[model samples]
Target chain A: MAMIETFGLTKRFGSLTAVDDLTTRIDGEIFGLLGPNGSGKTTTVKMLTTLLTPTAGDAHICGYSVREHPRDVREHISYVPQDMAVDPKLTGRENVVFFGKLYGIPRPRDAAEEALARMGLLERADDLVRTYSGGMRRRLELAQALVHDPSVLFLDEPTIGLDVAGRRKIWEHIIGLKERGMTVFVTTHYMDEADHACDRVGIIDRGKVIVTETPGMLKASVCRDIVLIRSDDRFKGTFPEGVTFLGRTGNELRFEVEDGDEAVLVLSRLFAENGMDIRSVSVRKPTLDDVFLSLVGEQDEQTAFDLTRFRTMLRRR
Target chain B: MIRTLWYVERDLRRWLRGRINLLSALIMPAAWLIFVGMALPIRFTDNYLDFITPGILVLTMLGAALQGGSLLMFDKILGFLQKFLAMPSPRESILYGKILFITLRGMIQTTVILVFAIILGAQFLDPVLLAQIYLILFIFGILLSSITTTVALTLEDHDTYAAFNAMIAMPLFFTSSALMPYDQMPSWLAVLARLNPVSYAIDAIRDLQAGIFPAMTLAGLLIGAFVVLLISVIIFRRATV
Candidate 1:
């Protein structure tokens, strides 16, 4: 049976459709919902974690319906929110024990200690969380979530603000959990993290899943190489059949081709025949960013400004 | 019920760790009992200490209850409320836990003020009367904390909640029978005191101290607490993070 399944899950915030018809399944693997800001990644996680009731359709975690049997679903899953969730006043051990008791674990103390040890926080478990570093607090949140030994875990931007090392350490624990046969559902805007950590990824945009596949498969399905050409003019002439025009901004044009070297040569000849001066040209292998851009389109200028303004308003609030 | 207790336990653990908060909570009420009770020189009562002790006790509980709302505010601000709501426990547990913690904390703080008043030469009552006094304070705690916690939940931020607290805390205490009896006040103030819930508990405690049961007033306070708590639970269950 699938560990997590959603059947046309939808959530509407008044006129805004935050998550629309989100249908997917994960079975004992780290599945990532990758999207840009306002793409409904966090909203989808919220619905599956039973935090927000879906306006239409339903989701099931471990065969328990989120709409009908929310408590059963809650019992099977744990969530780590994007914001800091640890109680700064309590010690690390106390935080874990508190979550354990909330989950009605029989031996909360033993379970809390073990979970703390697994997160490498046992040595400093007695220290107040306020005294711990940012990385330690994130790890402590993981320990608290694991105290119940849930079958599925949902992490929403788990390492959002962490430094490079902190992010790497969190991924290590996440991968470790996956190896032990736990189904992990994660949502992140960091394409690199999704490419490196996710066993399978679903690229969501504007509350819809664009594609779901393994990272390698997704890369292979998209163009292999991307050629970026900076020209002196916005040339109007179309060149050849093998080159696919991805996008254009100002004097720079982006294209997708099967082979980088061959495409560069073809493009140089075409540019000379068209009388357009090429300032510079570069060829690089396609990463997930290229796949995401091709699938979701470049973020329009107005939408990008609105996203920043929205984030600023949230921070002020 | 167990889940509710766990919520209470979590709040209690955090409360106990803040030693400065614990000590500071008693300071203002103690000052009222000592300075205002002794130095006011009011002609209505020969022993002002005995007369104002109940007021001080109720005031102490009032302060605790009002500040208790901030516990939920902090949880909301710090993102713990989101985590707690996502847990397996019923949402009512969070409400009950907060109400229980605020009431319990109020009871503890009132106990200290009661002891301090007695040590400073306020008249002492029998064990039965004392138990009734605690009972009245407990009901009052539930009433005020329910209102404050609900208000806290609806407000957008801590600063707004803090402003709301400041606007109500002093007015509720001063306009009630806490500082002076209703008869000693002007006609308008007397009318407001008669209608204030804070005065209901204080008057009942005074009646109990005077060897009367005050059955009607106690029943009224009980009904008020129950109704307010019911409303709070409804609001809480419908609350979304």
Candidate 2:
């Protein structure tokens, strides 16, 4: 059974459509909503979590409609937003216990303790959250979300600004949740995170899901073998078979080929015969970044996929 | 109900931990009671402290309620409001919890101010009258906090929220019957005071201190609090995340 599902879920802020006609189903697996900073990932998560009402359409979590039965939907789900929600003045234990009480757990303290232990925060559980580092605070947020043992967990940009080690720790914990049979719905700008952790990824652009598939399938479907050639002069004429010129950047020319090995040999021979001085030649497989670039087009230097830039663009619009 | 209490408990614990906030709450009201009460020589009663103590108490309530509402604004900015909104509890529980915490803070500040008044040689009222006065303060706190909550939720940022609160607090305090008797004010000011909920609360507290039951004033404050609370809940429900 699908643990979460949305049909034509739309949310508009003034004249801007933050989420437009989002239709998808997230079964009992780790489903990732991969998008750039302003691609409406957070807006969609907000609508799913019942923090924001949709302008149109519907969503369901654990068999409860988000619009008609928000309380029930909330009961079955937990959300960890990009910002840390735990109070800085309160201790980790207090934060989890408070969340437990909010969920009406019968034994809030025990539940809090168990959650803290799960997150490996049992030792510093009595310390104020202000004393915690960024990673520990993120863990505390995850612990608070898990105190109720929710069926569906939503994490929005869970490792957005964390260090490499910090992100890895969070990813381990998220994978652990999946092992415990919790359906995880995560949104992130880190393509590598989604590629490695997500069971399936939906690439959202301009408030729409442009593609939904496993990471491998998405890479395979969108991109072919890329042949990169660096030369001093531009190649005006191309006579190589099975090689199609793609585009150029600086002094490098790129081409898509059926087979990288054959293309590389043919291109090297052709370049030598044509007296072209090749600086470098290499064949590489397409990554998620390549797929994203192809789908969303290239972003300007100032409009890169960073939260601050995204917020600035949002404010301007 | 339990979830509401949980939120109230968390807020109270946080407020108590911030000793500066507690100290400031007491210091502001005490300063007004001592400085303002003594500087103004209106002899409505034997001791000026007795006369202004109730008014200062309302002022304290106003400040506490505004601060309480600003906490909500902070939660909204910091994204904790989204966490609470996604919880299983009813949305009203969040509003009620904050209001309850604000009322408790107001009651504490009022108690501290009352103690300071006694230190300044103001006589104490009867226990029953004291209870009645606290009840009136509680109701007044609820009304003001509800208004603050609505305004805070409506405004977008802390600066705007702070400016709006500061702009309104002084007028609400000075225009009410807190510092002077309503009859002693100019006729136009008296008319405004009659319509001010703070005036009704302060008048009830003053009457209780003078051993007179303020039935009409208490009724007005209770009704006003209920109506404002209902409006606040409605606004909170419609509040965008």
Candidate 3:
């Protein structure tokens, strides 16, 4: 059964629709909402977390309606917001304990301690959050979210702005949550991270989900494997039956082939028979970045301008 | 209700850790009491300290309430309020917790000011009258805290909130009977003082000090507190996001 489901979930700020008819289902697994800045990812997370009421439609968590039963939905889920929500003046243990109390747990102290231990923050749990590093603060936020043992967890850009090592640590813990049967729904801008961490990735652009599929399937659906053939002469002749010419840059000719390895062998033989000497041949698989770019298009000047304007509005607010 | 208490407890712990703020809260009222009591003439009572203690107490409560609203503003800016909004607990719990914490801080400041007033030769009332004074301060604390909370939730930035606080705080204090008797003021000023809720509280406290029960003033304070609290809750629910 789907633990988190949304149907036509929409939010509007005056005339601008932040989330437009968003419909999706996330089961008991790691699902990622992938988008760039100003793509409505955070707005959708806010709606699901019950921080903002949708202008239209509804969402459900663990069979509870978000609009009709927000409290019940909150009981079954926990949210780690994009911004740092932990109090810097309080200790890590105190932060988690306070969250536990807000959740009305039976034993807030034990729950806080256990959560800190899970995040490997037990030793420094007594220290003020101001004394902790950025990575530690992010881990503490996760610990606070998990103290109540929520079945589903929503993370908005969980590892954003973190160093590579810090990002890896957070990813390891998130993957561990999946292993423990927690339904994890996260939004992120890093395509590579989503490819590796999420069981399924939904590519959202301009407040609409463009595609939803496994990482490999998403890549495959956009463009096939590419076989790069570098030769002294530009190959402008007809291609093989299974190989289609993609593009050429300088002395290299690129072709989209069903099987890159087989195409390389066939293309090399064809080049030699055609009296053309090949300099180098390489087969490359398409990455999620390629898929994302193809689907969302390159970041144009208008999109960049929109993002800056959006950030300014947010800051003013 | 337990959840609300938990928030109050957390806030109290944080407030206690902020020793500098606590010290300042205590010192400001005492400074006002000493300066105003010594500088101002005493016409209504035999001792200036005795005449102005209730007014200073109300001033302390107002400052504490403003601080509470500032704290809420910080919580909103820092995203702590988002955490509370997203939680499973009732939304009213957050407002109640903040109000209770502000009232408790006001009460503590009131006590410290009362101690200083006594040391400075202010008259003491009977036990019953003292209890009534505390009750009046409590009601005033609630009223001011609610108003501040509503303003903080309504304004978007701290600079605007600070401006609004400054715009309202001094006028409310100066126009009230905090520094003088209501009858001693000009007719127009006396009318404004009569309309101010702080005037009612200070008047009630002064009446209680003179062994006169202020039934109407107490009832007015209660109704005013209730009305402002309802408005704060409504604004809080709408403005949290």
Candidate 4:
């Protein structure tokens, strides 16, 4: 049986449908719900974690329904929110042990130490979290969530607002969790991270799931190869059998071909034969970003006001 | 029950670390005890400190209990509420934990003021009577903190919650029989004081100190606290993060 399943799950805030007809099944694998802001990613996580009640339908974790058996569902899952959750006034060890106690762990102190060590926060475990850096604090949050050894871990934008190194470190820990046979559910808008990190991804847009596929399959479905040529002149004739013209923007010419390497050779010779001076030529494999844009169109950067996020930003100062 | 205590331990642990928060919480009540209780010379009483000590103790609990709302407010504002609500423990644990912690902290702060009041020439009551005073203060703390924590659950931001604290804390204190006897006040002011929950507690403690058992007042305060707590619990169980 799948570890996580949602049956037509829906949540509405007044007239706004935050999550609409979101139905999917996730087995014990690293699953990514990829979407832009306000695309219902967080709302879905909240509902599945038993934080917010669904307006319609229901979800199950480890075969326990979130609506009917929320306590059992909560017992099998742990959630790390997008915001920083560590208590700055308490020591790192205290924060983890606090969660351990809440989970009713038999040995909270030992469990806290083990979780802290796994997150590489053991050395600083005695220091107050207020003294830790942003990255260290994020790691501490992970330790706190993992103290109970939950089977399915839900991370809502776990690496948001972190440096490149910090982001990579968090992903490494996440990958380690999957290796240990834990089903990990994560959400993010960084397409490149999802492309390489997630075993399967579901692209959600406007509170609906647009498509669910492996990253490779999603990219392959969009286009196998994209060939681009930066030229001083446009090709007057394109009598190619396999290559199809994509579009032209300024002095750049774009095309889709069955094979990138073969297209690179053929397109270069074709440009020379056409008497077009090619400034640059390159063959690129389609990325998840490309697939997302093709499926969901452009995303508007401006999102509605999130009061909790705003208050979090204010308190950080 | 243990899970609830864990929640209380979390807040208590944090509250203990912030020495400034601890010191600042006592400063206002201490000022009131010293400036108004000691310096004020009223013709109605020879020792105003004895009369005002019960009032100051309740005021101390009032301040601490009202400020208790901010404990939950900070957790909500700082994103801890999401982590906490998603836990396996019952949701009432969080609400009960905050109320318990606020009440416990109030007891500690009022203990300090009681000792200080005695040192400043206020006649100390018998041990049994002092214990009764603590009981009245405990009941009052529970009643006020439950309401404030529930209010915190409904408010969206900390500023609005702070505004609420300022708006209610002072009026609740002044309109009660904290500063003067109800008989000394005008007719309208006496009526409001008689109706205020704060006055029920203060009057009970004062009656206890005066060798009169205010059985009816004590029973009324207990029932009021239990009813308010029941309503707060019902509201809290329905609350979502």
Candidate 5:
């Protein structure tokens, strides 16, 4: 059974379609929503979390429709919104206990302490949250969500504002939640973060899921095998006819072609014929972002971003 | 229930522990008691403290009500209400916690005022009458808090709440019999007092202090309070997004 499902879940803020005709299911260990800001990521999570009602369509959280069974849907779900959710006045432990009570858990104090320990906040449990750093509060937010042992956890930008190490620690805790049998539905801005954390990712834009697949499958679909070619900042100079230039980063040239399976052999022959010493070569599959951009027409591109202004062009019913 | 109680307890600790909020809460009320009482030359029928004791006790609730909208604003700003809403319990638990805290604080403040009054030589009415007075005060506290909670839930900022205070509370305290005896006021003012919820609260409290049972006054006070609470709940449910 699908742990979470949304059928045409639509939300409109005035004329802007924040989430439009979004149908998705999270049955995997971890599911992700990858998109740029104002791409309806937060709006989707807010709707699923019951913070806002859908303008149209419906969502089923743990088989309970968000529109009709909000309480039941909420019963099986835990949500950690992108914003600062912990109270500044309360201690880290106190915040956990309060949320635990909300989650209908037994022995809230102990549950709070255990969650705090899991989130690596045991040392700062007694300290007020206002005294903690940003990363610490984010961890506490995650801890509170897990206090009730919810089956499905919705994390919106779990590590968006964190430093590198903080983001790493959060990822470890996220993996920990999955190991404990919880289905994780998360959204993030960083392409690499989604590629790493999500077992399967769905790239969302203009309130719709452009594509959904395992990171590997997504990369494999675009670049069947990986061919690492070294070129200096020129797309036109590519020697291979079938090889299509994806882009360039510094001195490295990236490509997506029909023959990704025999990438190494094809690259060696090309380099050998040219009598050139390769600076550095990498034959790896495409990243999810590559497939994401392919399907969604480059979600991060300025042209795609400028489409947000069209939100105001919408007329009210 | 415990979750809601925990929030109520947390808010109470924060309010009582924070030096600035506490100091202002205490000093402002004490200053008003001294400044207004002294400036107006109002005295108790028997002892000055006795006559003003009920007013001062209710004043704590009034003062607290003025700032009550602040918690909702803080919840909205801090994003703590998100956690509370995500919890499986009825959402009313959030509002319930705030109301419970206000109710408890009202009693505690009244108790403190009575203690301080006694120390300063204010005698109690009959012990039985004291219970009636406290009951009247409790009902009034609920009404005052319900109205304030609705405003806080509806208003987006502390500035709006402050504006509401200026627009409503100032005029309310001025027109009510909080500072003067209703019987001694002008006829037009007396008519306003008879209809004012604050006046019913004050009248009910003063009547208890005056050693009168005043069954009808208690009934009127309760009905007024019930109406306010009903309106508050309706406003709260409607105002939230």
Candidate 6:
């Protein structure tokens, strides 16, 4: 069964459409909702996690409709929200145990200890959360979400705002969950994280999923080899066959096509045939970020509100 | 029910271990009782402290309930409310458990104040009067905490909760029968005070402290408690947060 399925799931914030007509299904795998900042990534997570009810449609998690059986949906999922959930006044251990008990995790002590140990926070468990670093608080938030061991994990920008070491630590823990067969549904902006961590990536833009495909498949579909040419002047030979001609800059042309080795050789001679010698030639492979930007760039003009909110949040950070 | 109880136990233990919240919870009421009661000597019909004791008790209940409300807001801002919502406990049980915890917490604070009052020579009630006082305290706690719980559940912001507590605190205290006998007040004031449920609570407390167990006072307090609890539950059940 699909771990999560949404049909026309929509949410409106007054005049603004936070999420619109979003329909998609995520099976058992590390599915990344790849978007830049806003793009309704958090809002989508909120709806699927049952934190915010959809204004228009429905979402099912672990085969339970978010509307029909919210609790059942909730029982099958764990959400790590964007905010650092630890109360500064409480000890780290206290924060985890408190949420553990609430999540119906039996033997809260053992669960909390295990969580702390997993995150390397066992010795600092007695320390007040106020004293912990930002990364540590984020770790606690993660620990709180996993205490109950739900079937699906909803991580909203789980590694956001963390330093390199911290991000790697959290990623390692996520890999541990994957090894245990937990179906993970996560969202993030860092292209490398998705490329490294997710088996499939869903590029969400303007409150819609542009495409859901394996990371490799997505890259192969949108990006193959980047063709760059630096000419003194004049147009190059007829646009490279089966190649996407990206815009050019000052006597230079760029495009993407499959079979870079053959394509590069053909392009080199083609420029030679045009009686123009190229100063520089380079081939670029597709990164997840490029595929993401291309899919989102198409409708980027319409979703101005997402950009505005993302900017405001970024300014705060 | 069991899950909620465990939640309550975990929360209470965690909160108690946090000195800042616990100390403030106990000290806020103590300060009001000792400082405000000492400064205001315009007695109603009995010991001035006794006259205002019920109000202080009500104040403590309100404070504790506000704490409960803030805690709810914290859960929301932090996303722990989702954990409870995910559970299969009766949907309304969340409200019930929270209200119960607030009510119980209010009762404990009231008893501590009562003990302090006794130690300070605030005068003892007869056996029946003591029972009536306890009964009145329970009703008042439930009523006050219920309102706070509803407000807290509906609101997800701490600043708004703080502002609400401040906005309601002074008027609920100064305008009630805590400082003066309802009959001794001006006609216009009496009419308004009668409408304030806080007045009913104060009157009930004053009746208990005066060594009198007026059936009418007890009856009014009970009805008021029931109405407030009913309204609070409705508001809580409907609130999306």
Interface RMSD score of each model: 3.8, 3.6, 2.9, 5.3, 4.7, 5.8
List model 3 lDDT by residue over A1-317, tens digit each. 58999999998876678789989999888999988777889888888988888899999999888899889999988888888878777899999999998899999999999999999999999998889888899999999999999999999889988999999999999999999999999998888899899999998888999999999899889889999888877554577798998787888888999889999999998888788989999999888999999988876656335655565435323
Weakest ten-residue segment in model 5 chain B by summed lDDT: B37-46
| Model 1 lDDT tens row, B95-206 | 8899889999989888888889889887664889889998888888888899899989877688898999999888988899988887789999999999888888889989
Q: lDDT tens string, model 6, A1-317?
A: 78888899998765667788988888767889887655789888878877677889999899999888888887778877766666786888888887677666669889988888877888999999989987888888777777777789888888878999889888888878878888899988899999999988888876777888898898888868888888886764576568777878887888777866677788888778888878988887888877877887644355345666554332211
lDDT of 1 by residue, A63-159 (tens): 9999889889889898998888788889999999999999999999999999999999999999999999898999999999999999999999988
Q: Candidate 5, residue A85: CA error in Å?
A: 2.2
Q: Cα miss at B161, model 1 (Å)?
A: 1.4
Candidate 1 chain B worst ten-residue window by lDDT: B232-241
TM-score ranking from best to worst? 4, 3, 1, 2, 5, 6
lDDT of 2 by residue, A120-209 (tens): 999999999999988999999999999999999999999978999999999999999999999999998898888899999998888999
Cα misplacement distance, residue A205 of candidate 2 (Å): 1.7
Enumerate residue pairs that collide in model 4.
none
Query: In angstroms, what RMSD does candidate 2 have relative to the true structure?
Result: 4.8
Per-residue error (Å), model 3, residue A186:
0.9
DockQ scores for all the models shown?
0.46, 0.48, 0.50, 0.50, 0.47, 0.31
Task: Look at candidate 3 and tell me the lDDT of residue A196.
Answer: 91
Q: List the residue pairs that clash in candidate 1.
A: none
Off by over 4 Å in 1: A226-283, A300-317
TM-score of 5: 0.86
CA error at residue B194 for candidate 1, angstroms: 0.6
Error of 6 at A29 (Å): 0.6
Model 5: lDDT of residue B61: 76
What CAPRI class is candidate 4?
medium
- CAPRI category for model 6: acceptable
What DockQ results for candidate 6?
Answer: 0.31
